[model samples]
Target: MPEQDDAEREFDLKWADNAERKEPSARARMLAARWKENPPEPQPFRADPDPAGPRRSSWISTVIVLGSVAAIILLLGYANFRAPY
Candidate 1:
Protein backbone atom coordinates (compact mmCIF):
# COMPACT_ATOMS: atom_id res chain seq x y z
CA MET A 1 0.00 0.00 0.00
CA PRO A 2 1.10 3.59 -0.69
CA GLU A 3 2.33 5.61 2.35
CA GLN A 4 -0.15 8.19 3.67
CA ASP A 5 0.66 11.84 4.55
CA ASP A 6 0.32 13.30 8.11
CA ALA A 7 -3.01 15.00 7.25
CA GLU A 8 -4.35 11.76 5.67
CA ARG A 9 -3.18 9.68 8.68
CA GLU A 10 -4.78 12.21 11.10
CA PHE A 11 -8.20 11.64 9.47
CA ASP A 12 -7.62 7.85 8.99
CA LEU A 13 -10.20 6.92 11.67
CA LYS A 14 -12.84 9.26 10.19
CA TRP A 15 -13.77 7.32 7.01
CA ALA A 16 -16.33 9.91 5.95
CA ASP A 17 -13.67 12.67 6.17
CA ASN A 18 -11.51 10.67 3.73
CA ALA A 19 -14.45 9.83 1.44
CA GLU A 20 -15.14 11.54 -1.92
CA ARG A 21 -17.08 14.84 -1.99
CA LYS A 22 -20.83 14.57 -2.26
CA GLU A 23 -22.62 15.60 -5.45
CA PRO A 24 -25.72 17.83 -5.39
CA SER A 25 -29.12 16.12 -5.72
CA ALA A 26 -30.82 15.83 -9.15
CA ARG A 27 -33.47 18.38 -8.12
CA ALA A 28 -30.78 20.78 -6.83
CA ARG A 29 -28.76 20.45 -10.05
CA MET A 30 -31.91 21.07 -12.11
CA LEU A 31 -32.76 24.18 -10.09
CA ALA A 32 -29.15 25.49 -10.35
CA ALA A 33 -29.17 25.03 -14.15
CA ARG A 34 -32.62 26.62 -14.44
CA TRP A 35 -31.51 29.62 -12.39
CA LYS A 36 -28.33 29.97 -14.46
CA GLU A 37 -30.51 30.28 -17.59
CA ASN A 38 -33.09 32.71 -16.12
CA PRO A 39 -32.48 33.75 -12.50
CA PRO A 40 -35.26 34.94 -10.18
CA GLU A 41 -35.58 38.60 -9.20
CA PRO A 42 -33.64 39.47 -6.04
CA GLN A 43 -35.58 41.30 -3.32
CA PRO A 44 -34.52 43.08 -0.09
CA PHE A 45 -34.24 41.04 3.13
CA ARG A 46 -37.56 42.61 4.22
CA ALA A 47 -39.57 43.60 1.10
CA ASP A 48 -42.85 44.64 2.80
CA PRO A 49 -41.88 44.58 6.48
CA ASP A 50 -44.54 45.92 8.84
CA PRO A 51 -43.44 48.71 11.18
CA ALA A 52 -44.05 47.53 14.79
CA GLY A 53 -45.95 44.50 13.49
CA PRO A 54 -47.67 41.82 15.59
CA ARG A 55 -44.63 39.53 15.98
CA ARG A 56 -43.33 36.97 18.45
CA SER A 57 -42.54 38.44 21.89
CA SER A 58 -38.81 39.22 22.46
CA TRP A 59 -39.17 39.29 26.29
CA ILE A 60 -38.85 35.48 26.45
CA SER A 61 -35.52 35.51 24.57
CA THR A 62 -34.28 38.56 26.50
CA VAL A 63 -35.17 36.94 29.84
CA ILE A 64 -33.45 33.65 28.87
CA VAL A 65 -30.23 35.39 27.78
CA LEU A 66 -30.20 37.83 30.71
CA GLY A 67 -30.99 35.04 33.20
CA SER A 68 -28.17 32.84 31.79
CA VAL A 69 -25.68 35.75 32.05
CA ALA A 70 -26.87 36.54 35.61
CA ALA A 71 -26.52 32.88 36.62
CA ILE A 72 -22.97 32.74 35.20
CA ILE A 73 -22.00 35.96 37.00
CA LEU A 74 -23.51 34.72 40.31
CA LEU A 75 -21.77 31.34 39.97
CA LEU A 76 -18.41 33.02 39.27
CA GLY A 77 -18.89 35.39 42.23
CA TYR A 78 -19.80 32.51 44.59
CA ALA A 79 -16.83 30.44 43.40
CA ASN A 80 -14.46 33.40 43.80
CA PHE A 81 -15.69 34.12 47.35
CA ARG A 82 -15.81 30.48 48.51
CA ALA A 83 -12.73 28.91 46.84
CA PRO A 84 -10.79 31.42 44.80
CA TYR A 85 -7.71 29.35 43.88
Candidate 2:
Protein backbone atom coordinates (compact mmCIF):
# COMPACT_ATOMS: atom_id res chain seq x y z
CA MET A 1 0.00 0.00 0.00
CA PRO A 2 2.75 2.50 0.91
CA GLU A 3 4.74 1.62 -2.25
CA GLN A 4 1.69 2.15 -4.42
CA ASP A 5 1.13 5.58 -2.86
CA ASP A 6 4.77 6.58 -3.53
CA ALA A 7 4.54 5.54 -7.15
CA GLU A 8 1.36 7.58 -7.67
CA ARG A 9 2.99 10.62 -6.04
CA GLU A 10 6.03 10.38 -8.28
CA PHE A 11 3.84 10.10 -11.39
CA ASP A 12 1.82 13.17 -10.41
CA LEU A 13 4.97 15.25 -9.87
CA LYS A 14 6.42 14.15 -13.21
CA TRP A 15 3.19 15.06 -15.06
CA ALA A 16 3.02 18.49 -13.39
CA ASP A 17 6.61 19.34 -14.38
CA ASN A 18 6.00 18.27 -17.97
CA ALA A 19 2.74 20.27 -18.20
CA GLU A 20 4.46 23.54 -17.13
CA ARG A 21 7.26 23.29 -19.76
CA LYS A 22 6.84 24.74 -23.30
CA GLU A 23 10.26 25.05 -25.00
CA PRO A 24 10.28 25.70 -28.76
CA SER A 25 12.91 24.14 -31.06
CA ALA A 26 16.15 26.15 -31.59
CA ARG A 27 15.71 26.20 -35.41
CA ALA A 28 12.07 27.39 -35.12
CA ARG A 29 13.01 30.27 -32.77
CA MET A 30 15.87 31.34 -35.08
CA LEU A 31 13.63 31.36 -38.17
CA ALA A 32 10.95 33.39 -36.32
CA ALA A 33 13.58 35.92 -35.26
CA ARG A 34 14.79 36.31 -38.86
CA TRP A 35 11.22 36.75 -40.16
CA LYS A 36 10.54 39.48 -37.56
CA GLU A 37 13.66 41.37 -38.63
CA ASN A 38 12.73 41.33 -42.36
CA PRO A 39 8.94 40.82 -42.62
CA PRO A 40 7.27 40.33 -46.06
CA GLU A 41 5.13 43.09 -47.62
CA PRO A 42 1.42 42.76 -48.46
CA GLN A 43 0.35 42.40 -52.15
CA PRO A 44 -2.36 44.54 -53.78
CA PHE A 45 -5.58 42.82 -54.90
CA ARG A 46 -7.16 44.01 -58.22
CA ALA A 47 -9.82 42.79 -60.68
CA ASP A 48 -8.55 44.02 -64.05
CA PRO A 49 -11.11 44.07 -66.86
CA ASP A 50 -11.06 41.05 -69.18
CA PRO A 51 -9.23 41.79 -72.41
CA ALA A 52 -11.07 39.06 -74.39
CA GLY A 53 -14.17 39.98 -76.41
CA PRO A 54 -17.77 38.83 -75.57
CA ARG A 55 -18.16 35.09 -74.90
CA ARG A 56 -20.25 32.73 -77.09
CA SER A 57 -22.30 31.53 -74.09
CA SER A 58 -23.53 35.08 -73.40
CA TRP A 59 -24.81 35.51 -77.01
CA ILE A 60 -26.52 32.10 -76.96
CA SER A 61 -28.25 32.90 -73.66
CA THR A 62 -29.54 36.25 -75.00
CA VAL A 63 -30.93 34.58 -78.14
CA ILE A 64 -32.70 31.89 -76.13
CA VAL A 65 -34.35 34.46 -73.84
CA LEU A 66 -35.58 36.58 -76.77
CA GLY A 67 -36.97 33.50 -78.58
CA SER A 68 -38.85 32.45 -75.46
CA VAL A 69 -40.39 35.90 -75.06
CA ALA A 70 -41.49 35.98 -78.70
CA ALA A 71 -43.05 32.51 -78.45
CA ILE A 72 -45.02 33.50 -75.35
CA ILE A 73 -46.35 36.63 -77.09
CA LEU A 74 -47.48 34.65 -80.16
CA LEU A 75 -49.16 32.04 -77.98
CA LEU A 76 -51.13 34.70 -76.09
CA GLY A 77 -52.18 36.46 -79.33
CA TYR A 78 -53.37 33.24 -80.94
CA ALA A 79 -55.39 32.21 -77.86
CA ASN A 80 -57.12 35.62 -77.77
CA PHE A 81 -57.97 35.81 -81.54
CA ARG A 82 -58.80 32.19 -82.47
CA ALA A 83 -61.60 31.61 -85.02
CA PRO A 84 -64.93 30.40 -83.60
CA TYR A 85 -65.69 26.69 -84.08
Candidate 3:
Protein backbone atom coordinates (compact mmCIF):
# COMPACT_ATOMS: atom_id res chain seq x y z
CA MET A 1 0.00 0.00 0.00
CA PRO A 2 1.18 3.59 -0.71
CA GLU A 3 2.24 5.81 2.19
CA GLN A 4 -0.71 7.91 3.46
CA ASP A 5 -0.22 11.62 4.21
CA ASP A 6 -0.80 13.03 7.76
CA ALA A 7 -4.05 14.63 6.57
CA GLU A 8 -5.47 11.23 5.60
CA ARG A 9 -3.99 9.40 8.62
CA GLU A 10 -6.73 10.65 10.98
CA PHE A 11 -9.07 7.80 10.04
CA ASP A 12 -8.35 4.11 9.40
CA LEU A 13 -9.94 3.20 6.04
CA LYS A 14 -10.23 -0.42 7.17
CA TRP A 15 -12.54 0.52 10.09
CA ALA A 16 -15.52 -0.56 8.01
CA ASP A 17 -13.95 -3.97 7.30
CA ASN A 18 -15.67 -5.79 10.17
CA ALA A 19 -18.13 -3.20 11.38
CA GLU A 20 -21.83 -3.35 10.51
CA ARG A 21 -22.57 -0.06 8.75
CA LYS A 22 -25.83 1.70 9.49
CA GLU A 23 -27.46 3.70 6.71
CA PRO A 24 -30.11 6.40 7.00
CA SER A 25 -33.70 5.62 5.98
CA ALA A 26 -34.77 6.34 2.37
CA ARG A 27 -37.06 9.17 3.53
CA ALA A 28 -34.31 10.74 5.61
CA ARG A 29 -31.82 10.58 2.72
CA MET A 30 -34.42 12.05 0.37
CA LEU A 31 -35.14 14.89 2.76
CA ALA A 32 -31.42 15.59 3.26
CA ALA A 33 -30.82 15.66 -0.48
CA ARG A 34 -33.82 17.89 -1.03
CA TRP A 35 -32.62 20.21 1.76
CA LYS A 36 -29.19 20.47 0.11
CA GLU A 37 -30.82 21.21 -3.26
CA ASN A 38 -33.46 23.63 -2.03
CA PRO A 39 -33.40 24.68 1.60
CA PRO A 40 -36.61 25.95 3.20
CA GLU A 41 -37.03 29.61 4.19
CA PRO A 42 -36.47 30.51 7.80
CA GLN A 43 -39.35 31.87 9.86
CA PRO A 44 -39.14 35.46 11.12
CA PHE A 45 -38.20 35.78 14.79
CA ARG A 46 -40.97 37.13 17.00
CA ALA A 47 -41.27 37.33 20.78
CA ASP A 48 -44.11 35.34 22.31
CA PRO A 49 -46.62 37.37 24.35
CA ASP A 50 -46.64 34.79 27.14
CA PRO A 51 -44.11 32.05 26.57
CA ALA A 52 -44.09 30.64 30.11
CA GLY A 53 -47.76 31.34 30.76
CA PRO A 54 -50.54 28.88 29.94
CA ARG A 55 -51.47 28.33 26.27
CA ARG A 56 -55.07 27.64 25.21
CA SER A 57 -54.76 23.86 25.33
CA SER A 58 -52.69 24.04 28.49
CA TRP A 59 -55.37 26.18 30.20
CA ILE A 60 -58.06 23.72 29.12
CA SER A 61 -56.02 20.78 30.39
CA THR A 62 -55.34 22.54 33.67
CA VAL A 63 -59.04 23.29 34.10
CA ILE A 64 -60.03 19.69 33.38
CA VAL A 65 -57.45 18.21 35.77
CA LEU A 66 -58.18 20.72 38.57
CA GLY A 67 -61.93 20.38 38.04
CA SER A 68 -61.75 16.59 38.30
CA VAL A 69 -59.72 16.80 41.52
CA ALA A 70 -62.13 19.36 42.99
CA ALA A 71 -65.14 17.22 42.03
CA ILE A 72 -63.61 14.16 43.70
CA ILE A 73 -62.83 16.14 46.83
CA LEU A 74 -66.36 17.55 46.98
CA LEU A 75 -67.87 14.09 46.45
CA LEU A 76 -65.73 12.63 49.27
CA GLY A 77 -66.65 15.50 51.57
CA TYR A 78 -70.36 15.09 50.85
CA ALA A 79 -70.18 11.32 51.41
CA ASN A 80 -68.32 11.81 54.73
CA PHE A 81 -70.88 14.38 55.96
CA ARG A 82 -73.92 12.27 55.01
CA ALA A 83 -72.55 9.01 56.45
CA PRO A 84 -71.98 8.21 60.16
CA TYR A 85 -68.38 7.96 61.53
Candidate 4:
Protein backbone atom coordinates (compact mmCIF):
# COMPACT_ATOMS: atom_id res chain seq x y z
CA MET A 1 0.00 0.00 0.00
CA PRO A 2 2.80 2.41 0.92
CA GLU A 3 4.83 1.65 -2.26
CA GLN A 4 1.80 1.58 -4.59
CA ASP A 5 0.28 4.80 -5.98
CA ASP A 6 -3.22 5.91 -4.92
CA ALA A 7 -4.88 4.57 -8.11
CA GLU A 8 -3.12 1.18 -7.87
CA ARG A 9 -4.02 0.81 -4.18
CA GLU A 10 -7.65 1.74 -4.90
CA PHE A 11 -7.83 -0.77 -7.79
CA ASP A 12 -6.39 -3.59 -5.62
CA LEU A 13 -8.88 -2.86 -2.86
CA LYS A 14 -11.81 -2.76 -5.32
CA TRP A 15 -10.65 -6.01 -6.95
CA ALA A 16 -10.43 -7.73 -3.54
CA ASP A 17 -13.90 -6.46 -2.57
CA ASN A 18 -15.42 -7.76 -5.84
CA ALA A 19 -13.64 -11.13 -5.45
CA GLU A 20 -15.00 -11.51 -1.92
CA ARG A 21 -18.58 -10.33 -2.74
CA LYS A 22 -19.14 -12.33 -5.95
CA GLU A 23 -18.00 -15.83 -6.86
CA PRO A 24 -18.19 -16.71 -10.57
CA SER A 25 -19.06 -20.21 -11.82
CA ALA A 26 -16.18 -22.51 -12.88
CA ARG A 27 -17.22 -22.25 -16.56
CA ALA A 28 -17.46 -18.43 -16.38
CA ARG A 29 -14.07 -18.16 -14.70
CA MET A 30 -12.48 -20.45 -17.31
CA LEU A 31 -14.03 -18.54 -20.25
CA ALA A 32 -13.04 -15.14 -18.78
CA ALA A 33 -9.44 -16.29 -18.13
CA ARG A 34 -9.22 -17.84 -21.61
CA TRP A 35 -10.54 -14.69 -23.27
CA LYS A 36 -7.96 -12.62 -21.38
CA GLU A 37 -5.24 -14.95 -22.67
CA ASN A 38 -6.49 -15.36 -26.26
CA PRO A 39 -9.54 -13.56 -27.67
CA PRO A 40 -11.75 -15.15 -30.37
CA GLU A 41 -11.20 -14.16 -34.00
CA PRO A 42 -13.83 -12.02 -35.69
CA GLN A 43 -15.77 -13.34 -38.69
CA PRO A 44 -14.73 -12.03 -42.13
CA PHE A 45 -17.22 -9.67 -43.78
CA ARG A 46 -19.05 -10.79 -46.93
CA ALA A 47 -21.33 -8.60 -49.08
CA ASP A 48 -24.72 -10.09 -50.02
CA PRO A 49 -25.28 -10.75 -53.74
CA ASP A 50 -29.02 -10.04 -53.47
CA PRO A 51 -29.86 -7.87 -50.49
CA ALA A 52 -33.16 -6.61 -52.02
CA GLY A 53 -34.43 -10.12 -52.98
CA PRO A 54 -37.27 -11.54 -50.83
CA ARG A 55 -36.60 -14.57 -48.61
CA ARG A 56 -38.72 -17.63 -49.55
CA SER A 57 -40.36 -18.20 -46.11
CA SER A 58 -41.18 -14.52 -45.60
CA TRP A 59 -42.54 -14.13 -49.12
CA ILE A 60 -44.81 -17.21 -48.76
CA SER A 61 -46.15 -15.99 -45.37
CA THR A 62 -46.89 -12.54 -46.85
CA VAL A 63 -48.78 -14.07 -49.78
CA ILE A 64 -50.83 -16.28 -47.42
CA VAL A 65 -51.72 -13.30 -45.23
CA LEU A 66 -52.78 -11.17 -48.23
CA GLY A 67 -54.91 -14.04 -49.57
CA SER A 68 -56.62 -14.44 -46.17
CA VAL A 69 -57.40 -10.71 -46.04
CA ALA A 70 -58.87 -10.78 -49.56
CA ALA A 71 -61.05 -13.81 -48.71
CA ILE A 72 -62.35 -12.08 -45.55
CA ILE A 73 -63.22 -8.92 -47.51
CA LEU A 74 -65.11 -10.96 -50.12
CA LEU A 75 -67.03 -12.89 -47.44
CA LEU A 76 -68.06 -9.62 -45.76
CA GLY A 77 -69.18 -8.15 -49.10
CA TYR A 78 -71.28 -11.24 -49.84
CA ALA A 79 -72.83 -11.18 -46.33
CA ASN A 80 -73.75 -7.49 -46.73
CA PHE A 81 -75.73 -8.26 -49.89
CA ARG A 82 -77.64 -11.19 -48.29
CA ALA A 83 -81.22 -10.92 -46.76
CA PRO A 84 -81.49 -10.12 -43.03
CA TYR A 85 -81.64 -13.08 -40.62
Better of 2 and 4 by lDDT: 4
lDDT tens string, model 4, 4-84? 989999999989988846788999999999999999777558855567865578879999999999999999999988958
For the record, the alpha-carbon RMSD of candidate 4 to the native fold, in angstroms, is: 11.0
Q: Which residue ranges in model 1 land beyond 4 Å of their true spot?
A: 1-56
Q: Which portions of model 3 miss their true places by more than 4 Å?
A: 1-56
Q: Estimate every model's Cα lDDT from 0 to 1.
A: 0.88, 0.84, 0.83, 0.87
Q: Of the candidates numbered 1 and 3, which has the greater lDDT value?
A: 1
Candidate 1, residue 5: lDDT: 94
Q: What is candidate 2's lDDT per residue for 3-76, written digit by digit as tens?
A: 56888899998887888677889998998999899976664577445557766788799999999999999999
Q: Give model 3's TM-score versus the native structure.
A: 0.35
Total backbone clashes of model 1? 0
State the displacement of the C-alpha of residue 50, model 4, in Å, after optimal TM-score superposition. 20
Q: Per-residue error at 45 for model 4, in Å?
A: 7.7
Kindly state the number of residue pairs that clash in model 4: 0
Could you give candidate 3's per-residue lDDT for residues 1-85 as a string of tens digits?
9999865764565565546986889999999999999997775578555568545787888999999999999999999999987
* Candidate 2 local lDDT, residue 55: 62
